[model samples]
Target: MAPVPVAEGIFTWPSDEPQLIGSRCTSCQIVTFPVQASCPRCASTKMEAHLLARRGRLWAWTTQEFPPPSPPYAGPTGDAFVPFGVGYVELGGEVRVETRLTVADPEALTEGMEMELVLVPFRADEDGDEVMTFAFRPAD
Candidate 1:
């Protein structure tokens, strides 16, 4: 089956180097992820699609020890669930993006460590197609 993105418009897909799709305010130059209609700083409506940096520094991190609550959480559960890492990565010193980490060990992750964007398997769709999602991993 074909692979598909977890959601639409979150990041560029079907590319060798995928980038997160964000918005930049033409008024204040403030950047936001997931694309915003208006600027948060000056409240300007002049926002444009901005492709965020693919590499960044890990600002902070934590482990998802338990499965997230249902209704919105659609991944594995019970014995099938695995603990994973989640963190905020500051990209190009412009914006901090909350993302899943490829590394899950707390002893391995450190603040200010270099991280690069990657695509990982998120879940399977109803038709059994693999769903892909964006994540960050330690840069060599």
Candidate 2:
């Protein structure tokens, strides 16, 4: 898998599952990933980056195993990504984030089930380097 370039001081992947660690404005209490200079809700510049939870509940999902047409992916060309579940997950005390589901069987996936984040190889680069990507796995 190719190496995915991550901007410095932008986001941190504490666990295998990457969470969009960001700061929330104390004035308006708006959550922004990457610790914005100013709050979008209250336009306050005071904010701090905080680590989020690693588990959430699946709100919805859809499989799209087809290889992405976007860049940074150089695996088997035209190879489908294999139908994997992708949907919104509500993190406890955090926010509802959209992510892909990491389940072997799509039919077994159900809404409202507990899910955990997992880091997996996204794709291989030209040098055969594995690009690590995070996905939400069903815990139930």
- Candidates in order have lDDT scores of 0.95, 0.67
Clashes of each: 0, 16
Superposed on all Cα atoms, model 2 deviates from the true structure by an RMSD in Å of 3.5
lDDT at residue 98 of model 1 (Cα atoms) = 99
lDDT of 1 by residue, 61-103 (tens): 9999999998689998899888899999999889999999999
Q: List the residue pairs that clash in candidate 1.
A: none
Give me the candidate number with maximum TM-score.
1
What tens-digit string does per-residue lDDT give for candidate 2 at 1-140?
54553334533544443665667787887666556789877888888776656787888777766766767654445544555667877876556777767774767888888988777665665677766656788784
- Cα displacement (Å) at residue 7, model 2: 6.2
